[model samples]
Target: MADTWTAIDFETANQDRGSACAVGLVRVVDGRPVERHSTLIRPPDPVRHFSHHNVAVHGITAADVAHAPAWDAVWRRILDFADGGALVAHNAPFDMGVVRRACAHTGLGHPAIDYACTLALSRRTWRALADHRLPTVCAHIGHRVTRHHRADADAEAAARIMIAAMSEHGTTSLAELSRAAGLRLGRLDAVTAPTPVAAPSPVGPAADRFDHWRRAAETPMPQACPDADPSGPLFGRTVCLSGDLAAMDKPEAWRRVAEAGGHPARNVTRTTDVLVVGSHAGVGKTAKHRRAETYRERGQRIDIITEAELLSRLGMTGA
Candidate 1:
């Protein structure tokens, strides 16, 4: 098994990936966590606020981080702790997004780091589970997690899960385990140049185009029927879809959201509960996406999920 790896988890103040209010980090050496660090951070906003929904999930409020250090003050220490070792997280994208966006917002250069996801590894390690959420996977592997959203506990749990997977697969290194699982390690670096934006293409079929809602008068609306299960995965949530989803058409995607008891929104706002970004979202720097990021920066709760994750939540396969 890999002798050293850093496991990280971030608890955001809102839907914006940059609104990271707390971080939990665990450094594992010889397949065991030897160092653990967790801290509350005052988000980058001048007038930082904490949403009730976010507070409910993590029990962290503005008052809790009023005296805490800002991300600029804390990021160096985090980098020093990682010390160039391979990084790991339950949902690698979300935590890595926090690092990248917070750096961008504060005008700091991102550190070059390679990271892996336990969530992806879990799918390969344990294929029998219906869902591979952090809590569910942690429980399956006999790791006790007392606090679901707490950064420290979650990070520690992720470390243990990685250790378990490595042992079960008889892998001697992170690269070996990643290869065995058919996962590509992700990387982040400071941007040295701007990317050119491609010209927009003609809108596709009405069912496939995300902007079809704009011409609703000409198209029949999908009936707004609530899901039968009040406690469905997305119950009482307002989900907004962004980018081009490769797996399904827009109408079918919206129907799935409603079927899961979530209201599908065309735009992202303070009221939007979730933002499902598709694979073809293309860097996610669009106007609506940026607006949603700003809402999160202001301390409004919004859950930004991947399209594959949304499908998993809805118990559907992309195929």
Candidate 2:
């Protein structure tokens, strides 16, 4: 853990000590990655004794882990991962279990680390995003992960995504992410509970909050796009936005992607995952994408998103 979020990807073996298996770590600080590491470990316990299907998912077999150190041997170094800063994993409950259980099994000294789930962050960032899976989210944001589901690769991808999501969401605090994302906070289960606030001395009739929100809700949303769902055809891929969009302003449109749990690209290249084109998406640019064959040659996808579509996704509808 560093000044920024540290994402951990751990591959388990048959639902056991797979606790300290191969892990990917990405340390983000000052909105950039200062360090990254990927390594495989042999936990002291036979927790990661692999089964056929598990081997298929991560391509790690019992033979592969036969010589690696057990959890007891690796506990100290693993603890160091959470030493400097906050940790992040896709669904932290599952990952945190590996950490906690490993600690118990090995009697390792645990660090006072704070960890958050990127999965929860994505949900709170955008309600209608198709899926929170790392690969899918990466595609929707137009980021390519060389290895899929492998602990280290997945963790690094999550770190990039966490950064992009925060930028897209205009959010700074983990508390805000927990509130919007699926990360449960203040349960007093995982961590200690906070003290209760002092009671108010006296109170009168409350202000009409319902009336105020009702008035605001009644106001028409801006009509930037026609109503269309289109099944999006973006369900299981990474997507990115490049350049000045013709359909909407950069900030607003990028915000829409994050709300959808996607990424925004300032430029399009051969590696560009998806280019959401707008009105100003003119001939030269189109030709360049074609000439470079960014989509065809590189297998990059191009999705034409109309202005109306963008607005609709934002829940804006002005009469």
Candidate 3:
């Protein structure tokens, strides 16, 4: 078990994993972060357009990195920062995909570096949790994550999460922890390695019924709201909704958004200015949610709030 590794996170400009716009790297030695690096890079042309949803997620914009280096120019620095140590990330596949695809797209050779996922580790470490999302796992382990989408902050959080897991399992090295969890640490170099997928746990009929209900609750239907206030607080804003709204149906919700002078959008895109995520929104992995998250990662000013919060902004108490 090596005590040193580099934990990394990448924020993409769009759905293409190779379209990385920003990266955060944290170097941990002896289970402590000793160095860190973060930077923004322009995605390749022809696919360089950043989606509104992704911009809302990370807050990065084309203008911000207009003069910044592109991936080809930036990859060397990332390699130097890793210094040949193993790499780690919350979701290793996404980040590694960015690295691999970016290299492939740019005609650059992939660097041979081993990587591990704290996400997979978290599942084994905190099996009782309802889900193993980064924020959820971070909160479960009492790690402070001030910024969720920023590559730097996310990388640091991932490092802390892994370190905490190591401590809990009495494993001094990532290799040992991977062995204990019956998981494999991923690698990238001569050949791409597949990320280990955790096997599904068996659930009884009652569990199946609950899951059905849960899935239904997550897939909210879009509603059309009319007679919006053109001069309202949400005026000029493009709003999208996800998850189940207990207070109102989709039509009523859309109506309220329109009434508030906002454009109600059925899909999340680069143009969306706000996303109202309702409770039980099983949309953490949805394409729409991911797009919104990408926008948030770039430091774009997209308001992502709960349904109640959106209603409060619209000066309403309920449907």
Best by lDDT: 1
lDDT of 2: 0.54
| Per-residue C-alpha lDDT of model 2 across residues 171-203, encoded as one tens digit per residue | 565555554454443110342232321111111
Whole-model lDDT per candidate:
0.73, 0.54, 0.72
Global lDDT of model 1: 0.73
Model 2 CA deviation exceeding 4 Å by range: 17-19, 46-48, 172-319
Residues 220-264, model 1: lDDT tens digits: 334434422343457678888877565544554675566445787
lDDT of 2 at 20: 58
**Candidates' TM-scores?**
0.64, 0.54, 0.60
What local lDDT does model 2 show for residue 220? 34
lDDT score at residue 67, model 3, on the 0-100 scale: 88
Put down candidate 3 lDDT per residue, 1-319, tens digits, no spaces.
Answer: 4478999999877555667899999999888899999989898663476766468778998898898799878888888888888889875755886787777666677657888877667766787875556777788989877888899999998999989988998888888888887676776666344333221111222335455345434544533223222323476688988765654445446655654457788788888899888755453466667789898898767887877677555543322
If the candidates were sorted by their lDDT against the true structure, best first, what order would they fall in?
1, 3, 2
Q: How large an RMSD does model 3 have?
A: 17.4
The weakest ten consecutive residues by lDDT in model 1 span: 194-203
